[model samples]
Target: MRYTDEELEVMLSNYRQLRSQLKDIRESIMVPHVIQDTNVGGSSSGFISNPTEMTAIRLAEDDVLNEIKNIGLAIENTYALLPKHKQKMMMAYFIDREPNIKELEVARRLFIDRTTLWRWKHQIISMYQIELEKLDSV
Candidate 1:
């Protein structure tokens, strides 16, 4: 289905958010938990049983992973349809998270003036709208 610009923006935001969450997800998955030990008379047995908590965690992780994959694919497909310059603009301005670089810095890195960067951003959005329309028609 074709998405609107707002929808696309939201998707992109979600993709970024999900990517940020991956570290926490990995940590959760890697956390080690000990199974409860059972003792009978003078014998102690170490038995590992699949706990519901772990199962729930795994299921949640899978859901998040699947969503991340789906969103990443959608973003990639749309991004690939853009021209190289537009792609670079999108990556620098939206995708790449360089905490130290502001928007003007990104423009400078791309060798374009701030005004040109703004203009290109609008043009890229228009191009993206056209691309999304085409996808919807297909």
Candidate 2:
């Protein structure tokens, strides 16, 4: 599927957020919860389970996981179509969080000048737009 630049950015942001959420969800699911015994006065004791809430959390996690998978696939498909340099640039800037680094630092890491890095960023975005258009046409 094709996406506009804004749409793609939003999807990527959502993907990142969902990933963090999935981590939290997995942690929550893994840890066992303690249940207080309600029949302390009686001879028998039983633990109460809230199936509804448990089921809801599981279902929500499943949905988020599926969406994350789909978004990843879409990203991979697009990345596969890019040239090696573009792929590396995209990975560095987006996936690897290089953009968060200082401009000079990122440029040094990529072995490019700061001005060229900025230029390549624009070119890469344009390439993505063209690629997305091609995918849409298909």
Candidate 3:
């Protein structure tokens, strides 16, 4: 839903890590689960409602995967919604910050001074919040 600037920034900063985690989870899910044979004796005790802890672990992993996917989708969708020039800014600042692009480099690439770059970054964070709001509505 709606996110604060700090939250949005954190999501963007961790975007790459999220993608890697999503990939890892998908790969793990592809692995076959070990099947264990359990023998039941007629001792009327409903002590455990759930039979298999593996099922619970699988459900939790699915939940985590879904959460990471949602965050990644929102970030990508927001990035896609921006104009080409703004997308460049976002890419340099967030998605492609591996080597950490300098302010001068970004300014030169976007043909703007440092002040405008900083302002545009703030604007982009606001845009991300708005985009997340729209997603929540849907």
Question: Number of the top candidate by lDDT?
Answer: 3
- lDDT scores for all predictions? 0.66, 0.62, 0.76
If ranked by TM-score, best first, what sequence of candidates would result?
A: 3, 1, 2
Q: What lDDT score is found at residue 112 in candidate 1?
A: 95
- The TM-score, computed over Cα atoms with residue i paired to residue i, of candidate 3 is 0.67
* TM-score for each predicted model, relative to the true structure: 0.47, 0.46, 0.67
Q: Candidate 2 on 38-60: residue-level lDDT in tens?
A: 57676665443676665455556
Better of 1 and 3 by TM-score: 3
Candidate 1 vs candidate 3: the lDDT winner is 3
TM-score, candidate 1, is 0.47
Clashing residue pairs, backbone N/CA/C < 3 A, model 2 = none
Scored against the true structure, residue 29 in model 2 reaches a CA lDDT of 53
lDDT of 2: 0.62
Candidate 3: C-alpha lDDT: 0.76
- Give per-residue lDDT, candidate 1, residue 43: 64
In model 1, pairs of residues that clash are none
